[model samples]
Target: MTTIDDLPIRDDLRGQTPYGAPQLDVAVRLNTNEHAFAVPQPVIEEMRKRLDAELSDLNRYPDRDAVALRTDLAAYLGHGLGFASVWAANGSNEVQQQLLQAFGGPGRTALGFGPSYSMHPLLAAGTGTRWIGSLRDPDFGLRADAAVAEIHRHDPDLVFLCSPNNPTGTALDPAVIDAVLGAARGMVIVDEAYFEYARSGTRSAISLLPGHPRLVVTRTMSKAFGFAGGRLGYFAADPAVVDAVQLVRLPYHLSALTQAAARAAVAQSAALLATVEQIKVQRDRIVDTFRGRGVQVADSDANFVLFRTADDQKAVWQAFLDRGVLIRDVGLAGWLRVTAGTETETTAFLTAAEEIL
Candidate 1:
C-alpha cells in the first residue's frame, strides 16, 4: 500500500517549514511580540456575561457572517481610526489568507518587501502563487523607486506592506505608500497589525481607500488590545474589496463565543488604550537601557525594540535563555528583537542582558 510519506506533496510546499513563534517557560517572555499586559477584568467580565447569554446557543451554528461582531468592529474603527467599513476573520492571519485567495492564486504573484512579516511568503506559497520578496535598504526602509520598478516589472496581483514592521518595528512613510499605490496595477494590502504601537505621524491607509479601490488595510486586536489569545482581526477597505474577502471565507469562521468576546473587548477599548500607553512607557524604558549599554537600536514604533550588537544574534538569544529571559532571535545575524514586558519582566531582562553582554 502507498504510505503517506510516499505521496507527492504540492511543489510549492516541498521544502517549506511551518512558521511559529518560540515557546519557552522563562521568567521574562518576549519572544513573540505579544502585548505586555493581560486583557482587563472589565472586558473579561463583560465577555463572561455575554457567554452566559449565548450558552444556550452553543449547540447551534454561529452567524456565518458574524454580523454583530462586524458591526461593532466597524464602529470601533470609526471611533479609533476614522475608518467606516470593516471585515474580519478569526485573526489577521486568516485575513491574509482571504486576501491571497481573493486576489492571487496559481501563476499570479504576491509581492512584498523582505524581512517584513514572514507570513506573506508562506501564505503565497500555500495558495500556489509566486512570492517575490524585494529586500529593503540597509536602514530597514523600503526603497520606493526600486519598489515601483518591481511593480512595473512583475505586475503582481497582490502587494503587502507592514507598517511599524514586525521584528524591526520600522514604520513606512505615507508618501512612499502612495507612490506604490500609484504604480501598482493590482490589489495592495497594507498590514497595520501594530498600528497602535506605531506612534509615527504616518496615517493608516484606510483613509486612502475611498479613492483606491485596490487598497485594503488589516488590523488586529492581538497587539494593543492585549487579546492575542482571542484571535480577532479586521480589515477596512472599499465595500467591493470587503465583499470579495467575505466570498472566500469559510462559513462560521468566527465562533459565537469569539464574537461575544470581541464585542466585549471593543466596548472596553478605553481600558485597552490605557494598557497600550503603559506598554509604550515600558518600551521606551527598555530602549533607553539598551542604548545606555552601548547597543545600537532601531527607531521603533511598535511595542518592541530591535537592538544590534557585535555579538552573534543566536549567541545572545541563547545567553538570555540560559539566564531565564527569553527574547526573539529573529535570525538577523547580529540583531535581536525584544518585546516590552511588564515592569518586573523588563527589569529582569535588562539585568540578564547586563550579565550576558
Candidate 2:
C-alpha cells in the first residue's frame, strides 16, 4: 500500500546513496585500511576493568565533556596540546559531522580537493552545505600554488584537507596547508585519519595550531592505535574553536563505557602501537613487490597502497576476491587500494595478484 514514493524527506536526500565500504565474507580482508593487528590482551584486560567499574553508573549520564578522556587524548598527542584544545566523538565521521554542523549549513559552502576523502562532500551535503569539489594534480597530488588559487576562486565557508589521503594513500605537503590557511577566509579542517602511519619527515597540521584559530586537525584511534571497534576519534583546535563545536554536539554524546574503553586503550598506547613499524615494513614490501612486477604503485605514507592495474579494476578486484582475499576497488578506472595487512595477509594478496594479473 505504501509502495509509492516514500513519505516526506529532505529535498536534498531524495536519491542519495549512503556511504559505505563492502562488508564481504573473505579470508584475507585488506579493504578498509584497518590495522592488521589485534589489540594486546593486556590492553583488553584494562579496558574490561574500566568498563566493569562503569557498569554501576549506567543510570547516570556520562561526563558530558568527556574531560578525562580529552585530557588523556591531549597527553597522547603531545604537541603541547591540552584538554581544552581537544574534542572527541564516536569516530572520525561523527567528528566531521560535528564540524560541518558548527560551521556549515544552508547558505554556506565547503570545499575539498577531489579524490581525497569521499566523506568530505557527503558530510557537507548531510549538513545542508553546498559542496565544491576542487582539483588535484594528475598524480592526485595537491600542489600549494594551484590549491591556493582554487581556494581564492571558491572562497568557501569551510575547507577540508586530507593528509595521507584515502583511496590514494599519499601524504599532503605541509606548504599546501599553509597556503590554504593563508588564502582562505574561513575554517580549514585537515583530516589526518592516517597521520600515525605517515613516513618520516611528514608534518602534521597540529603543529600549526598555536596561532591559527581557524584550523582543525582531526585524528582517530582506529588505525595505528588498534581501537577501531571502540569507535573513538578526536580533533585538536584552538580553545575557542573547540568551544564553538559545543553549540551543536548532543548533550552527553559519548557513553561512559566508550570513554572508559578509549581511556584504557590510550593508557596502553605504547604497547598497542608497537605494531606500527612492523606494519610499515609490510607496506613498503608491497610497494616494492608491486612495482618490481611492473604494476604502477603510488608512493604511500599511509598504511595502504594505491596501485594501478594493467587490467580492468573490477575484474582484478573480483579475481582477488575469488582467491579469498579482499581489497578495495575505489572506483578509479585503473586503480585499487589494499590495506597494509599482516605479513601473511600481504603474502596472500601478492600471491593472488601474481597468479591472477
Candidate 3:
C-alpha cells in the first residue's frame, strides 16, 4: 500500500496526527466535551420544518452568505452585534482557519497559551503560519502580566485566547485580555466556545469589540445547544474583519441543510439551551465530588472538570474505560478531563472514580 510517507506532502505535516478524541463505543462515554442530552424536541421539530421547506431548493447551492443565519447568530450573541459583525463556518476550527488564512499565513505567525485548544497551532501549521507556543501560569491561570510579557516577546500576527478554556476548564481573567489588547500589535482571536457555561459575571470578549476592530470572539453551538453534529461555529468581530475572512472562505461553504438546521436551533434557543444549566449541574457535581475526595481540581466555568489522577493518568484512564466509563486524558500529565454527561452517565463516571481515583 502507498503510505502517506511514500507520497510527497507538506514537509511540516509529515508526522502530524490529525486532531480527534477517542471515539469508542463505551457504556458511558464522556470523553468529548459534548452535551449529554439529545436535541430538544422543539428544536428538532423546527429543524424538520425548515429543512422540509428547503427540500425543493436542494438542487441549488446554499445561500452563499448565509445572511439569515448570520442575523440569527448575531441576535444570539447580542453584544449589540449585527449580521455584518458575525460569520460562521463548519466549526470554530474553520472560522479560525479562515482568520489565519486572511491574517496569519506565510510570513506571519499565530500564538496560543499552552494546554489551550490544541487545534489552534495545528490550524496555523495547516495555513503555513509559524506556531508560537506560550503558556499559562503553573496553576493554569493566564495572569495579565505574564500574558502581556509573552505577547511583547513574540509579537505574533494573530493571538488565540480561550475563555472557560478546554481541558483546564478555566475562564480567562478579563484583565489579561485588556492587557493583551493593549500590548499585542496584531489581531486577537478569543475562542469562547464554552461561553454559555461560564460562571455568573464572567464577561465575554464581545463586550470589548466596539473600539477594538482587531478583536474576534469565536463561539459554537456544539457545546451549549447540543449542536456538535450540526457543525456550526461562528465568530463576532468588526465588519471589516468579516470582510477579510470572506476573502478566504470557500464560496457557498455552508450547505443549505446546515443553514436551515442551525437557524432552526437558534430559533429554539431558549428551549435548546436549557440543557446548559443542566450540564453545569453535572459539572459542579464532578468538581465537588473530586474535591471532596481530596483530589486536586481546577475551578471550572465550563461543562467539564480537570482533576489529578491517583496514578499515571493513562493507567487511571484505562481503569475507567475498563469499568465502562470513558473520559479524556487530554495529554496532561497526571491529570484527566471528563465532560459532564447526563445524570446517569455522570453517576456512572463517579462510581468508576470511587475505585479508580
Candidate 4:
C-alpha cells in the first residue's frame, strides 16, 4: 500500500492535517456553524426555476466572469458597491485561496490573529505564503492598539481578520480593522461568514471600503441564506482588486446553475434570510444557558457559542456525541464550540450539556 509519504508531494505539507469537523450521524449535530433552517418553500421553488433555466445550457460554459451573479451579490451587500466591486466563487474558502494566489505567494507573508478561521493559514501555506500568527487577548477579543502593534511589527503582505471569529464567537471591534488598515502595508481580508447572525449594532467592515482599496470583506450565502449546499461565497472590494483576483481565478469557476440559483435567492432575500433572527435567538440561549451554569462563555456575535469544557474538552465532546449531540472541539484546551441550531436542537444540546459541560 502506498501513502503520501511515498509520493512526491510538497515538503511543506508533509505532516499537516486537513481541516474538517466530523459529519456524524447524530441526533442533534451542531458542529459546523451552518444555519439550522432549511430553505423556505418559496425560495426553493425560485431556485428550482432558476436551475431549470440552466439545464438546457449545461453543454455550454458559464459566464467566465460570473458577471450576473456578481451583480446580484453587489445588490445584496449594498454599501454603495456595484458589480465592479464584487466577486464570487464556489465558496468563501475558494475566494480566499484566489486572494492568496493573486497577492500572496512564495517569499510573501500573511499575518492573522490566532484562533481565527483555521483555513487562513492552510490557504496561505498552499499558496507558498509564509504565515505569521499573533494571539488574541485572553478574553478572545482583539484590541485596536494590540492589533496595530502586531501589524507594524510583521508588516505582512496580507492580513486576515475574522469577525465573529470561529472557535470563539466574539466579534472584532471595527476599531481594530481601522487600525490595521492604517498600519498594514498589504491587503486585509475580513471574513464575515457569520455576520448576519451578529447582534444588533455590530458594524461591518464593508462600510470601510469607500477609501480603502486594500480591504476585502468576504461573505457567504451558506449561513444566513441557507445556501450552503449551493456553495456560493463572495467579497466586496474595489474594482482594481477584482481585476487582480481574476488573474488567478479559474476559467468559468462558477457554473450557470450556481449563478442563477444564487441570484434568484438574492432576488427573494426576504424569504431566504427570514430564519436569521430565530437563529440569533438560539445563539443567545446557548450563551445564557452555559453562563448560567457558571461556565465561561464567550460573548457571541455569531451563531455559535464557545464555552469552557471541564478540563478535558475531548471527553466533553465525546459525552455530547454519546447523548446524540455533536459539537466542535477546536483544538483549544478546555474549550468547545456549538452552533446555534433550531429550537429543538438547542434544547437537545442544552439537555446534554446539563449532564456534560
Instruction: Report the lDDT tens digits of candidate 4 across residue range 1-357.
Output: 999899999999999888988999988889998889998888889889989989998999999998888888888888888999999999999999999999999999999997888999999999999999999999999999999999888889999999989879889889889999999999999999999988889999999998999999999989888888989999999999999999999998898988999999899999878889999999899888777889889989999998987769998899899999999988888889999999999999999988875
Model 3 C-alpha lDDT per residue in residues 1-357, reported as the tens digit of each score = 999999899899999999999999989999889888999777788999999999998999999999999999999888788999999999888999999999988899898998888889989999999999998888888999988889889989999999988879999877788889999999999999999999889999999998999999999989888999999999999999999999999999999999999999999999988878889999999998888999999989998999998799999999999999989989989999999999999999999999877
What TM-score would candidate 1 get against the native? Answer: 0.95
Q: Considering only N, C-alpha and C atoms within 3 Å, which residue pairs clash in candidate 1?
A: none
Clashes of each: 0, 0, 0, 0
- Writing each residue's lDDT as its tens digit, candidate 2 over 1-357 gives 772247687888888888888999889999999999999899989999999999999999999999999999999999998899999999989999999999999999999987888888999999999999997888888899988888888899999999988878779888889989999899999999999899888899998888899999999999999888899999999999889999999999999999999999999999999999989999999999988998888888899999988889999899999999999988889999999999999999999989986
lDDT of 1 by residue, 217-303 (tens): 899999998889999988988878777877889988888888898889888898877877778888899888888888888878899
Cα lDDT computed for each candidate against the true fold: 0.84, 0.92, 0.92, 0.91
Q: Candidate 2 has what TM-score?
A: 0.98
In model 2, the runs with Cα more than 4 Å from the true position are 1-4
Q: Which stretches of candidate 1 lie over 4 Å from their true place?
A: 1-5, 79-84
Q: Give me the displacement of residue 239 in model 4, in angstroms.
A: 0.5
